[model samples]
Target: MSVFLAIVLLSLNVGRSGGAIKPVVTFTPNWGNILYLDDVTLTCDVPSTAPEEPRTYHWYKDKRPIPGDQQTLHIIESLGRDSGDYQCQTIGGDISDPVFLNVTERYVLLQRLPSLIYEGDPLTLRCHHHRFCKAINPKFYKDDQEIKPSGSDSTFHIPNITRSQSGRYKCTKQIQPCYTPNVQELSDESFISVKELFSPPEIKVPPSRVIEGDEMTVRCDTRLDPLRGGTKLHFAFYKDGWTVRGYDVSDTYRVPSSQLEDSGKYTCEVRTRSDTVRKRSDGLYIQIYELFSSPQIKVPPSRVIEGGEMMVRCDTRRDPLRGGTELHFAFYRDGRTVRGYDVSDTYRVPSSQLEDSGKYTCAVRMTSDTVRKMSDGIYIQIYELFSPLKIKVTPSRVIERDEMTVRCDTRLDPLRGGTELHFAFYRDGRTVRGYDVSDTYRVPSSQLENSGNYTCEVRTRSDTVRKRSDGLYIQIYELFSPPEIKVTPSRVIKGGEMTVRCDTRLDPLRGGTVLHFAFYRDGRTVRGYDVSDTYRVPSSQPEDSGNYTCEVRMRSDSVRKMSDELYIQIHELFSPPEIKVTPSRVIEGDEMTVRCDTRLDPLRGGTELHFAFCRDGRTVRGYNVSDTYRVPSSQLEDSGNYTCEVRTASDTVRKMSDGLYIQIHDYKMQNIIRLGISGFVLSAAVCFIYFHNKW
Candidate 1:
């Protein structure tokens, strides 16, 4: 037997309208009761579905009207008279349950919020005392174990509360009063129980019985606390104790086509993203019934003879409940399709031959093609009129422009030597020559693509006693290798020449073949096909640097190859210049200096550079060898945006610095101070002489 703890629920007095959801009332500083002069705040919490605008709130105490109409009721100085049952109501919404508040004048007390506590909620334990008594070095304990001790803070707080924190809690502290000795005091123990944030998840499915070939969906359902509606939750689905769907925000798992093997015990799980609280639903058994049974192949002939007609049928039984459903059938021989799906279950072979002698099977499927099954195979042997054929290739190692020939070889029965036979040639399962009296296939000029697995078929003029030859492999070598891209002077600098070449080697035997080349940069065509194999940039700039590739192709484009990309980076001659001031802070009457800073590549060490200074976009000093500009006497008008420019001797690589603001201060204050000091020195000297003479 198990005993459950009871939660103190707030009883409702009035029924809510269908359009309204009940609101909740909560408080801050979570102390159930506090001493006189302590602060407490009460709030009205509504569901997220509420309109996103300000609303009017009505308050009541112990079934009586209160003075506040706002969402929150704040009490700065709590008094004994303020203790009562608090309730709130919002306009167009239901009235909230009532919460009790107790105010006492006790010397010391440990209190928690009077509202319900749920997992993931924050908990605060306050050790309160009378206003006149000062609490010092308060200590908190849970189940006789010291959790917090020797602290000046009057409260112990847990940011995220868990169910494991449930226990009896108390606080002890030293209290000191004016003109009285300090005394130790202990608070009454209060039990705390953290309720679940959400109920356990349960699996849900369609009410109808599940059947094979039908679509099915399973859902994991759980109810979360209304106050924590914004909390994130994850759901997962499982079958036969194995995971079917990993955790995701979606709570549903759908099966597009349910099968008999899908029938098993299924369960679903739900958890918060943090895995702090997890729950699994109870197992649910699901049964899927088949719509039809497996099919069987029926052959009429006990022994198949050459040139004789034969027929094969696929048989299957549908569920009695689905008697009106239509099914399709197909037939196969030696794992090769002989007949495609059709409403008729029978497959007819106009004339049985030795080539048709092999394992045979059949299949049945519904019109929707969702439910399908195959039948066991059966073997049928046909009397042969000729030995199996074999294909022989001439010049097994062939190159481009080489003449190739394939011949079908077979031996006919001596008694049937006069029978007329037709031959057909196939390459890679595609017909290359139709049935005719010829037994050889000839290619005047063989290329790389002409090489493949070749086979030949032989049959009598009436189309019976057919036989096929084994595959023969033919090889043809390429006329040229793939092209490659090469860059001239790979490491290029800005304002330098660059060239890209497409290179390839042609076979000595095919040296007379003509080839054209094209150039591309960053996948865009820069030059069309031409006899030249190189692309040149006389004066390459930074923009010319990119991924370059080239293509080589024959006159008819029958053979084309693109070279691998080559990345080219252009190095700058020098970095951009920056303006710097000698004294970051400038004032009137002070000499100010500005310098242009830039760095040139070591390779260009002897390059000459010139600098110029500007104020407000207008050049103040012409370009010169010196990088610095000096102002002998600064004035307030010097305060403006200043910039500098650096350029090469040829003025080809020019760069400018961003603007810098310089401000100058007034010089009148310094002059006045200097005059006043001189006047005071003269007056003091005259007064000293007059006093000495009088004495």
Candidate 2:
């Protein structure tokens, strides 16, 4: 019975677990506060017991059936207007509990912008609004016209706005309702006026007569109401519709040194935080008549005869005449005022004089009280005739060897104009020289000796005037002749000293006068010395062996002349002391000999005799009695050359002969006997010749 009961209970539990209905669902909130207009779903948990066919869903508000019967109910948008209690009911399941939904609105809030504005200024407008539990879009309106739609917080900014931007503004709220319609609300209007602040000041320039490069003042003054609220003001000046000066200042502006360009319609403009205004007074045209242009004068007949009439005109043109203008004209001659005239046009001068023959000018000046205007000067010249005279020679008589000077002088009208007198010198009916000098002439010395039958001639524009002077003769005296250069020991010795002397010859016709002497070498002056007649060069080196010349110049006015060059040769005696020997090697105790000779001039005769000997540097042993020297036996000490010397009181000559070798051998009877007999025979021959010559 227990087994059977267990099987039966297990079967019943299996049957109950096999097929059973359960509920599954998901919910989404669409509306605020009450969660109305939310989405909901209902599903079956058990697969076997779930409905196999289509099923319908019923929407409910607080467990009551809603008007729409559908599985899902959609709300486009949720708002406060659509807030309510909601539920859902399934066809095969129990109804759900009610859900409370609440709606909220969002809006932007705006505030009033600042009121006053100036031209070229920036401004900002704000539009703000609020909605209960909803997000609202804010929009701005100006003068009942929509300006801009701002999201959330509404703000509109304008940069560089003008007065036209001023208007009445308001903020509007936009509402979007869920499952309903949209709504809009407008706030109270805000007043915004861009008020123009101050008008530009009027400018006045005192003493309107403006001149270039003249200092003047321009003042700006006007009536305007002071601005408020930390406003900065600036003033600007305009001329000819263009801005001339602009600066930030409290009010007034002053300008000095109003240039010619500033002489135009001037207006002042004022700028403030709120307004920019300009005001212009009646234009006062400034006439700037500066004395910039120099005066010019015209002259007729620049050159005129000394007793003729001349006319000069001076005039000036300028503007702005305060009173009747009067000009004072003045005429000048050679930097001096010759005459003056007060006239507007030409001034006539009659009967011009010699004093008026120079450069004559006329100047015109306006009255001092009025604007200063001066006319340029006109230069005039008067003509006059004159001739150069008083021709003479300076230091009239010229000496033959002396210098001379000549000069010509003449008188001329100091004011001669257009007439240039030229001085020409004539010699023997021929023009030798000429000068443009109108007053004086000078001739250098020595050149005046060529003057013969001299005359002074002056050339003028019309005619030539000449004046002759008595013929003058020039006498010239010879000063001194050039010095002659003579050398001592004319035949020079090579590497020997020499001396040179210079002698000057003076003319007895002219008194004996000490003259200056100068020595020269190779056509170049070496030194100058003042002496009576002669000069000497004491010592000379090899380089001094050249053609030497001397010059003598008289202390009087005489030209220096150079003498002919003199050449001298210096020779030296032959110096011979070198001596050399050949076959220098010799055996001891052997007979050897040497010869002595030298390259001395044979004309010197035996005085050039040379002797040679063999010795160490200390002493001589063997010497050459004649041209050839012999020695019986040579020793090792005799290995040196045999030296020969020929010398005189002034010179010496020396030479060395070839070395002589000598060797000694062991004594033999035959050698000894032959040597002995040869020596005996040589001795006997020498004695026989000596004795025979004596007999």
In model 1, which range of ten residues has the least summed lDDT?
1-10
| CA lDDT scores, all candidates in order | 0.82, 0.52
* Candidate 2 C-alpha error for residue 85, in Å: 50
Give TM per candidate. Answer: 0.48, 0.33
Task: State which candidate has the highest lDDT.
Answer: 1
Per-residue lDDT for 1-695 in model 1, tens only?
00001112222123458777677667676566777788988887776556788889999889798999898899888889989999888888888877888887777888777766877666888887777777788889999899998777888989678888999998887877645885766465679999888888988888367767888889899988765565678999999999999999898988889888888999999988777678899999888877777788877776666676788878788777777889999899999999999999999888877678889999888889998889999887876667789898787666666688888988766666677889999999899999999888999887788878888999889875777888887777776677888887767766567888899988777788899999998999999999788999876678888888899988877677788898888777677788899688887978999998888877776788899999999998989989999998888988788999988787766889999888786788768888999999999999999999999
Name the lDDT of candidate 1. Answer: 0.82
What is the TM-score of candidate 1?
Answer: 0.48
Give, for candidate 2, the lowest lDDT window spanning 10 residues: 6-15
Residue 361's lDDT in candidate 2: 53
